[model samples]
Target: MDQFTNFTRKVSANLTPFAEKVGTNFSQLRQIATEKMSNSAIITELPREYVETENRFEPVKHIHADLVRLARKYALDEGNVDFNKLQNQFIEITSSIGEKITNLASQNPQQQNTQNQTQNAYKPLNVTIQHQLASACISNSEIVGASLYKFGSTYEKIGDFRVKMNHDILENCINLLQGEFTSNIELAQKSRKDVQGARLALDALKSSLKGASSSKQAATAIEIEKAEEVFIIAVQDSMKHMKFVLGSPIIIESLRNFAAAQLEYFKESQSLLETLVTELEEIKLTQDALYYSEVDHH
Candidate 1:
């Protein structure tokens, strides 16, 4: 009986604070509801500081959300050529061709040795046009086929550079923007919620103050003063956090990194394509001469 009495006492001690908290919350809710429904209940006006902070926070919130969305869109891997996949496909095609060549040359030991040597010396091409033209070159269409192979090789390098550019943008720009949103913007949003809750509680207490009896009015006034201080502090914290996010240099740095990656990619691509275009013009001259010579013979 003594042990049971002690346990009961311990439980009651634990529940006492919880019960008081529940009662306080219920009173605040009742006051808020009464203020909303009863025309006789006085509605407290929010502080000007809080109202101004909230107004500034609203636009910042939308801007942060928009930036995060744009970051995700920019980081999307779709439409970008995958260099690894292209290389793998190139390997598969070359391996198949090598096997067939080896099989056909198997009847003659000398020819088989030559085929093996050719296969060992072959460089794998990633582009489809390169593979097709290389095969045509092997079949004796030398000029056009060799020129196309050179063009395709450079094109493959451009594809690799494009993939690298995409990765750099993701790592340097998109990731940093997302990190800022999570660390600063999200924290500011949470603080804003705290401010809103503190405002509601402060307003509820103020509305209930008018109904307090003379004997309890002094205590109610003290509670309202404490609530006001809490509301003010909450608003200050929220505003500070919002300002940090709004003024962050990370966003500007991220934009710069994104632009830099794109610029590098385009510049390199343009340089490579320009060189290939010049080479193609030379190849066209050779091709025209070969065509005219063949036409004269026919």
Candidate 2:
């Protein structure tokens, strides 16, 4: 028992620095994911409607819905104005805002183009669909990354339990390495979910566009299809965040480096642990005479 205790202490002293270095490497992986993988340019690649106002022909824009309430509040704060004159001026200002609200409400437009332009303000979201998809991709990527982090945290807890069970630094290190490997697998699972989440939102947005009666909305239907392509591409690109990324030659090399580190750590630690175990077993067998003498003396 004494042999095991002292051996574990020695192993802990050796492994603590390695654990710190692994932690630093993990931080670097996250930074790389944030810095190298995040692509905001995709947002700008979307349709103009996302970045600017749609070219709809509704005559009024940014109408103050509380204009009347504001005017009434102003009147209450001030000394009494002539009621008749205030009423005339209020009507004129409201009339200037919209023909429908004014005395000209009964008059129809003479031109067909003018008549056609005065339709309902039901603007569909076709123009900005691409940008919305891009935003969704970004949001889901963050969600998947967050999920992966949580998986790692959970695995770390399991590692703690394993270390407690064994009371060996070698066990602790091996458990932690196993936990990381499991969490890496979970990252891929969560990424698939991220893709599904983005797809569901995009489908819902497309459904909402179906109610619009504008000619532009028809054009937008076509535009949304293009946006869907971008969404898929963006999602594919987001997988670069994985520490154990797999794909092209450059990515595979990166994955290999991380894998190699983990494997090397495990190999070296296991080798050291086996050596200690063998030494302890030999001491336990050969030191029996001394051990019994000390026990008898005590």
Q: Name the top TM-score candidate.
A: 1
Q: How many backbone overlaps does candidate 1 show?
A: 0
Ten-residue stretch with the least lDDT total in model 2 = 56-65
RMSD of each: 8.0, 43.9
The count of backbone overlaps in candidate 2 is 0
Task: Report the lDDT tens digits of candidate 1 across residue range 1-298.
Answer: 9999999999999999999788767766776687678887655566676677678768866765687677555544442334335445434554575565458556574564466458647744423333344344443423447575556556655655555565676678767877756588789889987876776677777766777888988998898899889988887888888777767787778779888988997898899889989998998998899999999999
**Overall local distance difference test of candidate 1:** 0.68
Q: TM-score for every candidate vs. truth?
A: 0.68, 0.23
Candidate 1: segments with Cα more than 4 A from true spot: 1-53, 79-144, 292-298
lDDT of 1 at 72: 50
Worst 10 residues of 1 by lDDT: 125-134
Q: In candidate 1, residue 14 scores what lDDT?
A: 100
* Candidate that would win on lDDT: 1
